[model samples]
Target chain A: MLERTKKSFLTALWILIITFPLMGLKTVFTGEQAEVGIRADAFYLAGVVFLCGMMWSMKGLIGRGIAFAVPPAKSCTGAIKTSVMKVPVWCWQVGILAMLCAFPFMGSEAELNKYFSFLIETLIYVSLALGLNIMVGMVGLLVLGYAAFFGIGAYTYAILSLNFHVPFWPSLFIGGAIAGVIGILLGIPSIRLRGDYLAIVTLGFGEIVRFVLKNEAAVTGGEQGLPNQHIPGAIAAPSLGFMVLDREIHYYYIAIVIMVLVVFVVHRLNNSRTGRAWIAIREDETAAMSMGINTFRMKILAFAISAFIAGFVGVFYAARMNFVNPEAFRFEYSVLILSMVILGGMGSVPGVILGAVILQVIPWLMRDMMPNLLREYFPSAANVAGTLTDFRLLIFGGIMVIMMIFRPQGIIGNARRKIELGVEEERD
Target chain B: MFQHIVDGTTQGAIYALIALGYTLVYGILGMINFAHGEVYMIGAYIGIISLAVFTATGMTLISLPLCVFVAFLAALFFCAAYGYTIEKTAYRPLRQAHILAPLISAIGMSTFLQNYVMLAHGKDKFDFPGIFRAAFINNTVQISGARVNYLEIFIIAASLVTMLCLHLMIRYTRIGKAMRATAQDKKMAGLVGININRVIPFTFIVGSALAAIAGVMVSMYVGATKFDDGYMAGMKAFTAAVLGGIGNITGTMLGGFILGLAESMGIWLISSDYKDAYSFILLLIVLIVRPRGLLGEQVSDRA
Candidate 1:
């Protein structure tokens, strides 16, 4: 108990140290303005509180204070196993704390808020990448229409929350449940198919969803989209003495919490029986079947679970953005998310997070930063050459090519996954 | 509805040409060559550049035939080089990897190519010079109140000639047979001393050339081309290829015509804004009922 308490204390201390600069800087920078400044100050305080809670919980791991509290292992394997199990939990606490602290800093500028939105968007992709990692990465299912689930989630939330005025949290769960059903329906066809055939079939299913959403204008709001819905408040009480609930900073934390939850759940699933079964099926479906695994059921489970997670994220996205359009849930989004999973280490959790963050945040950052720098440095050239948004696709495309050529395993790839996924073979 | 048929056929011919490239590449490499559409898009930009340069040189009405020929060659060379580079850089490394690697790389390359073009030429459409813009014969040969353009006849003839050439190339040539052999069994052909490397590049050259011709034809017909045209057009052509049979050349041609006809009729029946929805709906139904496509052979899992 003493050791655990000490460890928790250190984790709390580390979070405080890491997040202090951002909190301090925000208060200093935004001191002049009254309304926005006060709002920013409140956001920073909330961030500090959340960070403190996170750090307190993580102190044992960060400070090695729980070393004695850990049950003495008889073998090296046991010790290593325990350490491995503890590492991810520690990482999650650290990540959540970092995100909370970063939220206030992100809201310092209007432009930075867009990047923060993108960061939240990245969290959504991380959710997707984790979910897809189960299907394509673990189960070896080549799903070309993963966006169908995303659309289902988005449409479900939009219809329920917008039309019926249902609360965000309930609508979010319903959306996930609806998407889960759809995923199961789609997975039935997978029983008879494999590889490219399965891919094409999923592609068809995805297109069907897209077309239906496009044509069913009454239910979906069609091309015009469902818009202007206010973001749901976190607390029911109106007299909480804090009004950061509707702010972008508050939404950022909501996304961060959702992302952390998703990561935690997926991480647990990865180490569970289902994740192992998925790996078995991925390695060899025939072998998995020979081992008495119901391969069909597993594939369907993988699809359903992945879709469920995607739908969960989709709800948050709709609420945060307060908009849902068919165009937003295009085939390209599916492909892009898929690319994030593959380009990152396929089965590696941290790799998926890194991929999601880089792909989502980097482009937006570049979009915001590059054009202004170009304009400021070369005013005359900027007039004639145009901004980065005009040429953003080219630069983004170049980055992809470079990544594919140089590091197919992605920025934070796993070595074992690299070999298993055949990334090494491709490198050769 | 003669005009609809004419317009549909013209678009169908363009799709057919691009689909041939997709089919041929798929047949040889067993890969979708998703970047093929971008190659077609690039060809249109090349044609635009060629027109701009030629027009600036005081060439008033450079015969449509000569202009098209030049555009075709320029597009062919540029796109062929791109195809060769893509194969060498993106695909060559992932040759032994899971099929997903190459597919993802192709997507990356697709985005890269589109973005590259968008940057080089602004995001908006570039007008094709008026050399082939005018209708040859504006007479109404009405089937049911729709007027037909005689210029569409030229598009059909061009498409036929390109198809016939491709047919002959695959049927008669030694390299063509080598491509077929390589597609059938890469290792066996390599052991038999067929240079798979040479044959693959040659396939890309032929495929990209056809796509270039299609791009020029599309520009001539549409009167303008955009940097992002490849994505929509590519998706349509891919749909056409899949609708017929992915690796079957002749099936792709039939698929293109069917898709074009279906799209035109569907648009006429419904709203034009939902034309994409119509094609995708048809594609979905076809995939669900006939996953192997109308003429595609069953693909065996090798990896």
Candidate 2:
């Protein structure tokens, strides 16, 4: 306990020093004259850091997580989770389908549209994260520029549907096709380069794509995004559902259909011959080649399939939003999706979906819903939470770093992937 | 043409300085310091903040060069401190984890630093004060019938001098020799009684100091900077590092010059709006044609 206190104190002090330049120093200007003064938040930040340093998450949770490679995988909530998992798979699926079907009716009529949009957005990310899982988890190739393909998909729909007068249905598949072809083209160049080098290339590619979208003012509509991005006759589609549905409700169901389709396809692909080939390549490229597994083709197939899902989803995203902008597809978005895959349980479908939902819905709740709910009961806590919501990115960054150090296997890591990582547990 | 050359060389010098950080860390750790760009960014913020603080203190009236010198020192100290603290907290723990882990953490670190700066420093771009205006120095110099900014010349000359000092330090100093040994083989270097822990932190400090230098120079050159400015500059510098052979020092400098030249020339030939794409295109061509980079490579291929 004394040691923990000492460490936390030092960490807090160190944070104060590192943050002095930006946090402690404030240049306030009165007309033409300026003064350098210290702000009051330094103490607040120090207190938070000190408190967090001694918290169980810093030791017990992170320590247990790191040591998870050793079986048992015991935690406070682990038993409940295992019990839930023990229930038959089809039973869980039916339960989830019923819940999803009932989701639209769960809220007030006025707020139903907002919930639908939120769930739709979450579903879109679920599809995107699954695609990333194929590359990062299954193939063991980190594509840092996944957002570029997503942008290409969105743009393909916007341009095809808007300028060429293509309808929503063809534009959707064509978007995926174009992105998939480009994914193949991108894969060939970086095929020989492994690990970090591949990451940089993909990162560069993502930026290059974004720059092209921004620079090509005529077609992409530049910084303002594509003009009239709404999918023509999207509301009028599947006429049966359209009759009973509000427009937002229709988009919500469409998003669910896409997500379900993605989950199904990905699940099938996971058990197929090609899936085995990918797992082999990921395990050992040379060994896979020795086994006549054709590592190159399998790797390319992963890229093509991953990009296709992103493109297909991008069309849906554009259709739902009714506007597509270059800003919507940035490197941060790629990283966000990557984090979802990593956080959920990289190679696991249910885990990725759960991860996507947790990351997306929690942030939204923190920002919009929870604070308002808390305002009625604990006003002080609500203020702290509101302030925290403002620093969401900082907390995200901190959690990511802390999580990687403590639990590289993810919260619900795949059994196979855990072996692949084979991280040595650290002792304090 | 002359102007572009001058501009390219000036920008290239800065790239070389930042790329050295990437190359140096990649050399020692075998993982790209994704937050190296964030370090450069923080350096810029610190450099500008220190400049603002110094200007408010009445130090500029006493001796202008001393003011600039003091600002540089402040930036160096804080940047090195940041590099040391970040590595100790974030990267050190993941040394045994998967390769992808460190990269993700770095991305998170990058995001955190950007937002931290945005929150504390405010989102608006800070204008770098005109240092030359205080002194009676001519802001421009005539070179081969072309008027070049004195700041550009200063940036180039300053970086070259710093690089020379770095080369000397690496060749002569005991710690430098240890770093070289560590880079070659960590286990062997450890066996030879070198303190690998000290060497790793030292590498980060030296690299961050170089980035600090570049950050100060670029802020002066650009006249203004924002919280997110480091992302693009960092990417370009990382490309420059890879182009020169990611783990090589001299090659990184050469790569920086070539990349800068490509960007300027590409801008002159194509539209200026697509200048950011030029570095990426150059990277692609290099990766395809000569993956080892222009300098061949120092680190063994991981695969």
DockQ of each: 0.16, 0.56
Residue A358 CA error for candidate 2 (Å)? 2.9
CA error at residue A413 for candidate 2, angstroms: 2.1
Tens digits of per-residue lDDT, candidate 2, A245-286, equal 338888888888898899999989988998878888877787
User: Candidate 2 iRMS, in Å?
Assistant: 3.4
Each prediction's interface RMSD?
14.9, 3.4
After superposition, the stretches of candidate 2 with alpha carbons farther than 4 Å from their true spots are A1-7, A29-33, A53-81, A228-246, A376-386, A417-428, B131-138, B298-303
lDDT for each residue of candidate 1 in B1-303, tens digit (9 for 90 to 100): 666776778788888889888888777777778799998987777665565544544453656557556766776666676667667767777666656667878888898877766654557787776644554544335556776666577778989998998888888999878988887778889999999889888888788888888887788778788978998888788888888988888889988988888888887777786777666677767766777777887765433
- Tens digits of per-residue lDDT for model 1, A1-428: 56655654554454344223222221111121111111243245445555566666677576575455554534667878778768775886797678666657744567576556666677778888888877878787888788889888888887776567676667778989999999998788554566665766677678778877877787776677775333443212112244535566667677777877888888888889888888888777778889999988888898899999888888777777667778887878888888888788687787777776677765775676666677788887675335566656656766776676666556656555556666444321
Instruction: Point out where model 1 deviates above 4 Å.
Output: A1-115, A228-244, A370-389, A411-428, B1-6, B60-64, B135-146
For residues B68-139, write the lDDT of model 2, one tens digit per residue: 788889899999999998888788887777666777778778888888888887789877776633242356
